[model samples]
Target: MENIVLRRVIPSDNSCLFNAVGYVMEHDKQKASELRQVIAAAVASDLEKYSEAFLGKPNEEYCAWILDSEKWGGAIELSILADYYSREIGAYDIQTTRCDLYGQVTPMEGAPEEFDQTIFPVLQDRTIGTVIEGCALKLVEEAQRKRSYTDTANFTLRCGVCQTGLKGQKEAVEHARATGHVNFQEYS
Candidate 1:
């Protein structure tokens, strides 16, 4: 098997899914806000297609919620993004070593002629978690073959300044803010 290398995009806030999509597109997390706008517009334009069943709420309400920076992205948004971009999206659950494809169900009109793939991490909670493109699926497959795949959800965060450890990102971020400790590293 060819060596497959992947890059990780850490979430700085609740917009991690948007950030991951932006990262896959532009390799920059800052562009997530723009991606969010694009997604919201796309979702708004096709409310009938993206109904309450897919959104878990009325289309308009879901669009508004998605536009909120505090709101996180999920599978429905991933499907929309894949359609909007006209590319195949691979959502990988690191915990389960499972990958699902979005936007390849039906033929897309005016899609690029070349086959393109984008990979995004799906967190344990089923939320669109992180972005990892460029041979990410190959890397995952290789890890699975080697029995070395580890779930990031079980990783612990350690404060760089005080060596304080936390179980999750939420707690780690809170710890950093409360104690003004800016540096943290994840340990499994």
Candidate 2:
């Protein structure tokens, strides 16, 4: 298997990442060309707004990793919200990082150890399912530990085919539903 690079999202990566997402989403064979343009604009806008914070120490409590796929194959974003409040949803005073995005699934278990240490971060190759499970557990633990987080955490996991809902209480429930395991089950 070919090893892929995993690196922090950088300025130069803007178009590549956007296009890769477009490529993945394009399998639908719809108006992917136009969709790609929209994605590019959104990514560029994000870069303009957060590029400095991304590189600085404060870290914006947010970070995105790009799969080293020559272009950008997969990406994930994590964010730590400090003073988050939502009235319609009825939540407040939470310090939790949202698992913003989990890019196309990457099977990490069978990956060469050399690549693990050399190329990807622990989270880089995590399957969308794995990332969702891990994030859910972390969110549950964080809320329990703090107690001030008098609210709930909700998450969505986008596998290659389906989008599923996961809650703090239903960790295993979600995994069992991921019936099609491409990269993960084989390696395990």
Candidate 3:
């Protein structure tokens, strides 16, 4: 089989999503700034399509916000990038094994062609892709058996902002809503 290997590492910064996507598509992390500019330009090119109601802010404001390197990106940014690249972008949640796909929708005429430049947890060329998949599943199963994943529903969390204790995800959200605190730490 062809040598399938894991993609390059992405820094776990606020701009990780941008960096990850750029690395997968272009094998470059410096593209984060350019990707942000791409998103801003996409929004600017279509104000009605990316309206205030659609984006939860004025187009100009949203464009400016996306250009800020400290800002975290979300669905709108992903969707714009997907359209710009004409490729289906998938974000996988490791703990949940959930994959969210962008650019899967049929595009209007004159849109760019669709292709896949993706990420993977590829095992080195020891055996095959199925073997790699099986290894991953086995690893996940072992982790589950060990209870290595955090139980967000029943775990103890502390609010980093106010030092308030929270019992679970619900409580954490409540604490954030009450005091505008967003950072939480999990502890036993």
Q: Whose lDDT is greatest here?
A: 3
In the range 1-188, model 1's lDDT, one tens digit per residue, is 12224435446576877777666655565766787788888888887887889778998898787888866677877887777777667666654557874211112333332322334445696533322333456566665776553334456889989999887767866887799886777686
1 or 2, greater by lDDT? 1
Q: Give the range where candidate 1 is weakest over 10 consecutive residues by summed lDDT.
A: 102-111
List TM-score per model, in order: 0.54, 0.21, 0.58
Clashing pairs in 1: none
lDDT of each: 0.64, 0.33, 0.68
lDDT of candidate 3? 0.68
How many Å off is the CA of 158 in candidate 1?
Answer: 17
Q: Which parts of model 1 are misplaced by more than 4 Å?
A: 1-3, 101-138, 141-188
Per-residue alpha-carbon lDDT of candidate 2 for residues 1-188, written as tens digits (9 for 90 to 100): 33222222223332443442333333222322343434334444565555655434222322322222222222221121111111011111225544323222223535532333211134556673354445444544565576633232333333333433344424423554556422111100
Cα deviation of 70 in candidate 2 (Å)? 19
Off by over 4 Å in 3: 2-8, 101-188
Q: Higher-TM-score candidate among 2 and 3?
A: 3
Q: List the residue pairs that clash in candidate 3.
A: none
Please give, for residues 1-188, the per-residue lDDT of candidate 3 as tens digits. Answer: 23222223467566888987786677566688899999999999998899999999999999998998867787888888888887767654456644463111112333332322343333576354455444445545554666655566799999887788899878987887888888877777
